[model samples]
Target: MLLRNVLLLLLCLVAATPRSWADDGYRLWLKYDKLPNAAERQAYAQGMQFVAGSGATPVLRAASAELQRGLSGLLGQPVPVVAAAGSRTGGVVLRVDAQANAGGQPLKPEGYRIVKEKNNLVITGRTDRAVLYGAFALLRQVQTRQPLVGLNLSSNPRINFRLLNHWDNPNGTVERGYAGSSIWQWYELPERLDPRYTDYARANASIGINGVVVNNVNASARYLSAEYIGKVAAVAGVLRPYGQRVYLSVMWAAPKVIGGLNTADPLDPAVKQWWTAKSDELYKAIPDFGGFLVKANSEGEPGPQDYGRNHADGANMLAQSLGRHEGVVMWRAFVYKANSNGDRFKEAYEEFQPLDGKFDPKVLVQVKNGPIDFQAREPFHPLFGAMPRTPLVLEVQLTQEYLGFATHLVYLAPLIKECLEADTYAKGSGSTVAKIVDGSLDKHELSAIAGVANIGSDRNWTGHPVGQANWYAFGRLAWDHTLSADVIAQEWTKMTLTTEPAAVRTLVNLLDQSRSIYVRYTVPLGLHHIMGESIHYGPQPWLAKAGRPDWTAVYYHKADSIGLGFDRTKGGSNALALYRPEVQQEWGNAQTCPLSYLLWFHHLPWTQRLSTGRTLWNELATRYYTGADSVLWMQSQWAAAKPALDPALYADVAARLQTQRKEALWWRDACVLYFQTFAKQPIPAPFAPPTRSLADVKQLVQLYQLK
Candidate 1:
């Protein structure tokens, strides 16, 4: 009885003690932890004594509130938002003018200028939303521990529409989502707004993402119903203050599914009227509704094609429905057939290129970065330069659907930059994919870019804590495509993880090299779409039987006793013809082709020596071996970051690195052992063969499939 009483007392004492908070990454890069350097804090506090701005507009109020909150947290002192900057000294001032100029340079509608004026800084912009972006930029500098003195920053989004496409279903399951359940509590939404929704909006606003498509592209008709429109409006209300407009992915057959129409053809008068009324109802519910992202005639989703109509007919109909609503129709060009008679790479180009000028002015052809699905690496889609008459939205996958789900630590900035920097050679030598998507090459007004959201209900937003960087990178690059991958990595590292120079250097290197490492171990030498059937988790190069021929792994790699890789040259599928003559010349031949993409366009002999001076088999084995081993190097780099990082966050990444190393080995052994059957050669010298036989790897595949 005495011992039990002592234990109860001890429990009481433990409960009374204040628990230290763990960094669960919920705050993301906006941690705003108090400045470590007192001198630095004082300098920032002196420059930001108070925020002077009009709190009349919702976006202005949001900017003021953010400044106050961020300054209070960063400086350990309250920074009030004042009505005006009259006679104020050593404080930040905000000004909005529709035709504002930054240092004698004309500013875009959403452009911002932050320059030192006398003893204070003035953040002037052409619009309230631009001022909000300037506010975030100021906070970013403070968070990165940069001096406020002599600060001059001016920026504008390179692309007009930067959006996050959420592949979330109404029932809470996110398609290909690795984090926890969907963040949208659909059943409780219209009446009960989750505070997380507002936080999500703040995060997006801080990163300059102005639009969000809240539903899956493989859409549901229920989102168009009156009750669901109310729920969507609730979300929009939360995002409006942050200058984010909400969009929905509409089902092509919504008229028939929800509006009781006999035929849902784009040309049908009744169907058109039904869509027009529904769009009007949506605009009435949400004033700044961003419009629709449609996945029509693709992957069995009902589309105008079912009614003997084309993509232009469907997209133009939606654009007409929007009328003068200041909205757009983003028609997906990711269509393909089940029949595998032709190269999947040529399908989208063939189908969409011909009808380029047919799309309405308000319609943007949303093309994936690659012609195929989002592989680890892919040539820039031919459609980027092919369709000069149309405005194209460059869609990239931030969620690691085909890459390693949430388990692998892959930084996507390199992949995005590679595609962006790819010379399309559309008009001449200097034309790039970035120029095409940003409306500079064709000189079109409407342009957009989208990243398939990696976010979910996880406390960190993204499942893996490091996955947050990808979201951050996407936003930064979307705002300004010229920023290098390393620059973005360093910025993210300093803000999210540590300010220590040594740790920052180490983390940046890790992030910069991560994507290449992932590509090496998983799909080296441009081997694409060979992941496990349906789940896409692990290596399954031997995947032969699937519902569709193209769905099978063997259909892509074409491995045999002679050699490996798909033949897309003139002698094979002639898919190279889809690209320009320069691109075809660059990638068509085995000798001149970049080694990274050699296997993608050619089917060479196993004994063929690459530019790396290694035979094909030896190079493949070397990459598999070294790539798996590089995970240890990443672990070491992350370990060196512990002293400067949040303990909880450091430990979280360390644990994930361990998982990554184990999986890397799994990928290495599985691919090498399985491919050995085709190469019919032993593992290269200095790198030992995988002890596990091909049968063992096959068993692993079977086990993963069961999961």
Candidate 2:
């Protein structure tokens, strides 16, 4: 009886105990733990005596509360919030400009400036939303231990609309999400507002993302119903104060499915009226409704093409419906057919190029970063420069659908930077994809960029703790494309992982090298779309049959006895001609082309000697071997920085790194052995061959598919 009583006492004590600050990754990069260094704390605390601001609105209240919470935690003392900073020095003041252009140089609607004025830090902006952003920036500087005495910084977003396209469903499942179940509990949403929603909005606003599309592209008609609109309004209410506007992905045939219409023809009078009425209802419930993102006529989704109308017809119809409201239409350009004859790479370009000037003023054509689906590495899409008259939204995937998902530590800033910095050569050498998307190249007022979100219902927000860096990087780059991937990585590492100098440098280097290492093992030398079927995980080079020919790996790689690679040159599909004359000149020849893109444009022989001074066969084998081995190097780097990282966070990543290494080997063996069928060559020198046979690897992959 005494033992039972003691056990009950122990259980009660455990339940009552609060978790350690470093025990979970729930805080993300917003961690405001007290500084370990007394000197550093004193320096930051010197300028943060009090947080002076008015809780005039939800946004202002959020900013003030965030500052108080952050400063109190960092300074190890309560930082009180006051209505004003009159006669007070060493305090932070929030100031909003009644006139946007009243300041000497006018600030953008969402721009912020932090300066040292009269011995106090002043965060001034044209709007309350800007002040909120300024608050987060100040916290960032303090968290990174940056000096604040002489601080003067001003920043604005490069694109007009920076949005996260969440492929979440109403049924609590995320389409391509690697993290757990959906964060939005549709069943409990209208009545029970989860506090997580507020945190989600805070994180987004902190990084300058102003919009969120909270549904899948393969949308359902039910979301357009009156009942669902109320649920959406509730979510929008929480996000509105943080400068976030919610968007919905509308099914093209929603009028037919839910509004008792005979057809969803864009030109039909009744269909047009139905959409207009729906738009009015949406705006009535949520006045700040951002827009609609539509996926039509892609992958068997219903579109206006079914009724003998083009993309412009469909987009213009939606644009007309939203014209009465302050909303825009994002018409997707990711449409393709299975019968494209293994040339899906050219489909989007061919379809959208001619309709460039026909789109309505309220329509922004949303184009994926590449012509193909979100592969690890792809040449910049041909449509970027081709559509000179249309405002195109650059859509990038943060979900790692084609990368290693949440399991691998592949930093994606480099991948995004590669596309952003690519020279389209449309208006000469300096014409970059960034310029086109930012509206500077084409001189279009409407501009936008989107990142398919990697967020879900996991405790850490993202499955892998470090995966948060991708989310952070996307927001930063959307605000300013010129920010280097290296700088962003270092900042995220310090803010989210550790602030120690040595550890920060080590983790930064690890992040910088991770994407390339992943590329090498999975799809080196311009290889594309060879991942496993359906799941898009692991290696499946031997996959020959699927529902469509284009869906098969064999259709893309085109491996034969004499050579490997799909020939997109003049001798083959002639897809290279889609680019500008300059791009064609640069990538036209296999001899002068960068090896990174060699196989993309040309099919070379197995024994072909190249600029690297090795046969194609040997070089391919070397990359596969070295890439798999480099995971060991990454593991070593992580272990060396063990002392600086949180124990739980460190252990979590270490276990994931182990899994990555094993998977790397799996990729190497599977690709090397499968391609060896054509090469008929032994594994290159100084690298040991796989212990398992080709059959063994195939059997293992089959088993993985079952799991």
Candidate 3:
């Protein structure tokens, strides 16, 4: 009891520290540093004399408090929150009126509009949560130094449920996570609510992410217990004021594992009753609990398939249990057979397409961005346009599991943008993946997009400083899918780093090119799933054995003496048939297909000439060599921005770039030399031959895979 009291006291102290004002990335993009120009600061100060609001509810109080905190720092003055501005001029007013609209523009639920009323700046929204978002949007204007006059900024989320799915385990380990440990303090929770929880909630709410799944999909049933429910309730309380809800990844056999039951079958009446009871228990603990995220019959997890039932049978059962509660069941569509000989890229489509209109209204079939696991680059999943009856939640991985695991300076905005902008052709030429995800393509009411969280216990949040850009980008893009990757990168850079023109342009350009550059060195020409064994790092093209054949590097690459790519065309696995005919027409012909995706659909001869005026082997060799060399250019760009960036922040990224340069060379040498044996060609011109042999690279990879 004494020790528990001490822990609770320590948590109170941590929560009282406000925001970390250090040069570290703890503040994320929310840093409200004083404006560098005093003239500009003074002008902005006039509009923020005092923040006026009722503080009637928790969210209302939160809005006024944030305005005070943000304006106090940015203007270098005391900006107090008051009950009312009364007749005062040149003050900020926050209003939550059901009839509020942005000037003449309309607002969807949880949307905000900022406009100048009389002489005061007014931020209004339809709901208290909308006003809270408005509060952050106003702070964003000051932090980015946008003009305060003539304000008519109206913003609404494109998707209904924007979320972050944390692959955090109950025991403090994070699956595929690189930053220190899990941020969730499981042992100290329920009694000791860390201040960091509030910070995490604010960061998500600021960018319009409305929900978070707090446990790993490869789940344990312990999270569903009465004891854990109390812990989750404490977390929900902290997040509730910010309009974010707590979600759990449920173990499929929770009925058997946590509750005493005969069989964990969804159709079993006893099992149905168990879930109904469980849902009630969960809502009683956390009234606004966001529903379950289930990963079953994929990678050895238990599921409805084990009991002679399909995915719809399982998902509908859980959705029915929610009954009158306002929640959703996100049933993951990432299923693949353990020992199947079929192409893994075609597996999810083959399985889920048959049950398109069969799902309950409250269920969403969450699909990954690509057909396979989160490769550096992949053709958008066929499931996007293929499943019109079921509302699909696009699940993207933010953790750099396959993209070098937080060490490489790869910006994932480009990767995500590529997938979003791709034409699914489900409803015609302009039927983009984004349209399908936002529910406009299918005319479905429910919509969502989730990013597998990269966040952890690191003071900087993400291990790599630039990694924060991906998190910010996800939220902005989720709120509005039409926002370009370049625009998002520029916005994040100006707000997080310096607003100096030259430095901002340089950093934005670097971020724009980082994903493609990483792809060129590591997995160029549509290469997929060839990373090292279980860790999914470095290069392992020679890897041929794993527990499952599909898990081997050799299974996907299919490199041979005659060719160097997977044959997904009709002549091979016929995976191209899964896409619409228009997409097939565009991707079918090797001569016309985009060079970036040439290898994904077809396997060409080593000497076959591409439209780039280079043979297959030569183009592959050039990208590998040039990709590694471009990391040197990235190092130079970072060095040039040193004058504009914070010293500690600049140093951290500079050091990571050094490690990235080393590992990029490792990827280049390992892949080039290994593939050379099959190509039987010299290294292309403007590129020197690798100093090391393929055997040498294989030995190094073997050592990396050692337990």
After superposing candidate 2, which stretches have Cα over 4 Å from the reference? Answer: 1-22, 99-104
Worst lDDT window (10 residues) for model 2? Answer: 10-19
TM-score of 2: 0.96
Q: Residue 532: error of model 2 in Å? A: 0.3
| Per-residue accuracy of model 2 over 266-344 as CA lDDT, tens digit each | 9999999999999999999999999899999999999999999999999999999996799999999999974666588
- Cα RMSD for candidate 3? 4.1
lDDT ranking of the models: 2, 3, 1
Steric overlap count per candidate: 0, 0, 0
**lDDT of the candidates, in the order given:** 0.90, 0.90, 0.90
> Can you tell me which runs of candidate 1 are displaced by over 4 Å?
1-19
Candidate 3 residue lDDT tens string, 251-343: 999999889997889999999999999999999999999999999899999999999999999999999999899899999999998788889
lDDT score for candidate 2 against the true structure: 0.90
Which of 1 and 2 is ahead in lDDT?
A: 2
